[model samples]
Target: MKQTEAQWQSTLRFAVGVTAAFVLCEFLKWLPSFLAAALVAALLGNLPIRPPAKVAIGLLVTISVSALGAFLLSVWFRGMPFVMFGLLAVWMLLAFHKMLGGGSPLPPLLMLICLATIPVITLTAPAYADVLPIALVRGMVVALAIIYLVWLPWPAVQPPKPKPLPPPRETSTLRLALLATAVILPLMLVFLLFGLADVLPVMIASLMIVANFDPRAGGRQALALIVANFGGGMCGMLLYIALSTTPSLWFLAGLLFFATLAFGARISAGGPTAPVYVIACNAMLIIFGSSLGDSAGSFSLWVTRVFQFTVAGTFAVGMMELAWHPPVRLLPLRAGRSSGSSPGKT
Candidate 1:
C-alpha cells in the first residue's frame, strides 16, 4: 500500500514536470501542439487506458488521415467550406470504420481528429498559407513527447481490472442526419450574410466536429475551449493594438509565442481542462498573424471566427445528444486464466 502511494506521488510529480517541459518546448520552432499531444498521450497510456503500441499506431493513422484531408482541401476544393466539410465527413467515416474494426481504438481516432482539426481549421482561411509543414512539425513534436514520457521508469503497479465490453448500441442515423443538416444550414446562412461562403463552412464544420465528437471528458471541455479562445483573443488583440507600431514583427511573434507557451503549460497542468490555454494560445497566433497583414481587418476576422466556433459547437452538441445516443463501452480484452484451473487443461 505504501509503495502504491509512492508510485502515485511519483506519477503526479512526473506529470507536472512533463507538462512544464512540454510548454517550454512549444517556444522552439520544432515544438508546439504535437509535443503537447504526445505528453498527454503518454500520461494517458500510463494510466492503463490503452496499450502503447495501439496509441502509436493510432497517432500514425491520424497523421496520415490529416495529411490526406489537407491535400483534398487544398487541391480539390481550394478550401471551400462546404465542399471540404463534405469530403472531411467522408474521410472521417472511412477512417473510423477502418481503424475501429471490431471495437478498436475509437477514442484515439477522435483525439487525432481533434489534433488535426486545429491545423486544418486554422489554415483553411485565405490568411494562413502553406501551413501543412508547420502542422506536420507540430504533430511530430507531440508524438515524440508521448513516446518518451510513457517509457520513463516508475514503480510497477497492477493494471486496472478489465471491464467487460458492452454490446454496441444502435445510433440514430436520423438524428445524425438532422444534426448535420442543422449545422450546415446555419453555416450556409452565415456565409451568405457575410459573403464568406467559401470559408464559413470549413470553420463551422471543424469546430462542430471537434467540440461535439472529439474525446472530451465532459461539457466542461467545450466550455473551456470557448472561454480560452475568448480570453486569448481579447488579450492578443490588446497586445497587438498596443504594439502594432513596432516594426520588429519577428521579435513580437517570438515574444507572444513564448508567452503563450508558458501560459499553455500552466493551464495544461489542470489536465483535460487545459484546452482553454491551447485555444487562447492559438487565438494569439491568429490575431498576431492577422495584425501582420491589416490591423483594420484583423479584429473583424477574429470576431467572425469566435462566432463561427460558437455556433458550430452549440449546434453540433445539441444535435448529437438529441439524435444519436450511442452507448459508451469498454474495449474488450481476453481474460486471464485462473492459476488453479488452467495448469493442466491445455
Candidate 2:
C-alpha cells in the first residue's frame, strides 16, 4: 500500500513538473521549444532521484562539444560528402559504442541529437545553424532548472542502488554500435541529400527508436515502439484540437497537466509497457509543442505528421529485422524440446 502511494505521488509529480516546464517554454518563446519539455520529461522519467549538480554541467559540456564538433565538421567538409559522412559515421560509432558499453546514455544520445540536428539544420538553414547551439544550451538550462524546482516540492525517495552489471565485451559493443549506426546513417543521409528539414520530426523519431532499440528483444520491441509512437500521436492530436477550440494558454496548461497525469500513471505502474508509455508521452509532447506557433497548423498537416512518424517507425523496424537475425539453432532446439515433451505427455 505504501509502495502504491509512492507510485501515485511520482505520477502526480511528473505531470506537474512536465506541464510546468512546457508552459514555461511556451511563455518564454524559446526556439525549438519542444526540446525543453522533451528534455524535462526524459530527465524526470530516467532519473527518479535528484541528480547531482554536476549533471547539469556535464550536459552543458556535452552539448557544447557536440554542437561545436558538428559545426566544424559541416564547415570543413561541406564540399566533400564522402569525407563528411565518414567523419559523422565515426562519431556515431563512438557514441553508440559508449552507450552499448554501459556508459551514461545521455552523452551518447546528446551526441547523436547534435549530430543529427546541427548538420541537417546547417545544410538546410545556415543562418539557423549558428542560432541552434544557443537554443539547445538554453533548453538544457531550462530543463535542469525545472527538474530542480519540481524536486523541491516532490523529492523522490531514493531507491537502493542495485549492483552494477559488468559492461559488455568490446566486440559486442562494437557490433551493436555498428548496427545502430547503420540504422541511423541512412536516414541522416536521406535528410541531408533531400534537404527534408521540414520533416525533422521523422528523423528525431528515428533517432529515439534507434537509441532505445535492443537486438535481444527483437521484433516485438520494434512493434511496441511503433505502437507507442502512434499512441503519442493520438494524444497530440487530441490536445491540438482542444487548444484550437479554446486557444488559451491556461486551457493548454490544464489539458497538458491532465493528459500527462494519465501517461504518468502508466509510467509509474512499473511494467514492460511503462517504457512504451514514456515514448508515447514524449511523442505527444514533441508533436503538440512544435505545432504551437506554426502558421499552417491544419488538420491535414497534423495527420501527415502522424503518418510521418509511422513511416519512421516502420522504417526502423524494417531495418532492425534486416540487420538483426536470431540464431536459427534456437528455433530447432525449441522445436525438438517441444516434440520430446509431447511424447511424454501422450
Candidate 3:
C-alpha cells in the first residue's frame, strides 16, 4: 500500500512538473508568439473529451481550410459583399469535403491553405499585423501546452467504435447545417451587443463542432468553461488589483503563463467547468489595466465578457443538440484492445 501510494505521488509530481514547464515556457515572453487558437484546436483534437482521431483530423483540416478561405474572400472581394459571401460558401464546401473526406492528403492540405490565407489577411490590415502575431503566438503556445499536458500522456491510436451510421434515408448533414445556422444568428446578435462580434462566430462554431462530436462531454465542458471563466475572471481581477502597482511586462507574462497552465490542468482533469476559468484568466491578463483606467469602464468590460461567453455557450450547446444529437459513448479502449477480445474484434 505504501509503495502504491508512493508511486501515485510520483506520478502526480511528474504531472505537476510538466505543467510547470509548460507555464514557464509560455510566460517567457509575456504573450504567446504562435498561433495559439490553432494549437488549442490541435490539442482538442486529441483529448478524451474530443471526437475520435478521424473526426478530429477532419475538423482540424476543415477549420484551417475555412480560415484560409475567409482570409482570401476578405482580400478578393475587398468591397464586394456578395463576392465575400460566395467565398464563404466555397470555403464551407471545401471545409465540408475535407472534414467528410475526399482522399486528399490531410496535413499538406491544411498547411497549404492556412499558409496561403494568413499572409493575405494579415497584409490587408497592416495595423492588425502587430496584434495578430501576438494572438497567433499566444494561441500556438496555449495549444502546445495543452498538447503536452493532455494529449501526449494518452495518445489515441485506434479507430473509435463506429457510430450507428446515420439512418440511410435521413438527411443528417442538412439538419446539422440548419441547426448551426440557427445558433449562429442569435449568437451573432448577442456578440454584437457585447462588442465581441469578431470572436463570436469562432467561439460558437467551436462549441458547436465540439458538441456535435461528443454531446455529453461537450455539455460538461461547456459548463466547465462557464465556471472556469467565472472563477478565473474573479481571480484575474484580484491578481490585477494586487499587482497593479507592479505591472511590469514580466509580471504580465508570468501571470498569463501560470494561469494558462492552471487552465490546461483543469481541462485535462475533466474538471466540472473550464471555459469560465479560461475566460477569467484571459480577462485578468488582457484587461489588467482596465481598473486603472476607469472603474465603470472595467466593470462594463467585465459584464460584456461574461455576457459574450454566456451567449456563445448557449448557442453552442443548443445548436449541437439540435443538429447532431450525439449519444453518450464510452471512452475508447486503451492498450489497443479490450480484454478477452479476438485479434479482429474489440
How many clashing residue pairs, candidate 1? 4
Query: Which pairs in model 2 have colliding backbones?
Result: none
TM-score of every candidate = 0.49, 0.88, 0.50
What's model 1's TM-score? 0.49
Q: Give me candidate 3's TM-score against the actual structure.
A: 0.50
lDDT of each: 0.46, 0.78, 0.43
Better of 2 and 3 by TM-score: 2
Candidate 3: C-alpha lDDT: 0.43
Ranking by lDDT: 2, 1, 3
For candidate 2, which ten residues in a row score worst on lDDT? 162-171
lDDT of model 2 at residue 109? 80
On the 0 to 100 scale, the lDDT of residue 147 in model 3 is 46
lDDT of 1 by residue, 210-315 (tens): 3324222345554555566556556656656655567554555445545544653444244444444544554544444344344355667756655654555455
Error of 2 at 272 (Å): 2.7
Considering every candidate listed, which one attains the maximal lDDT?
A: 2
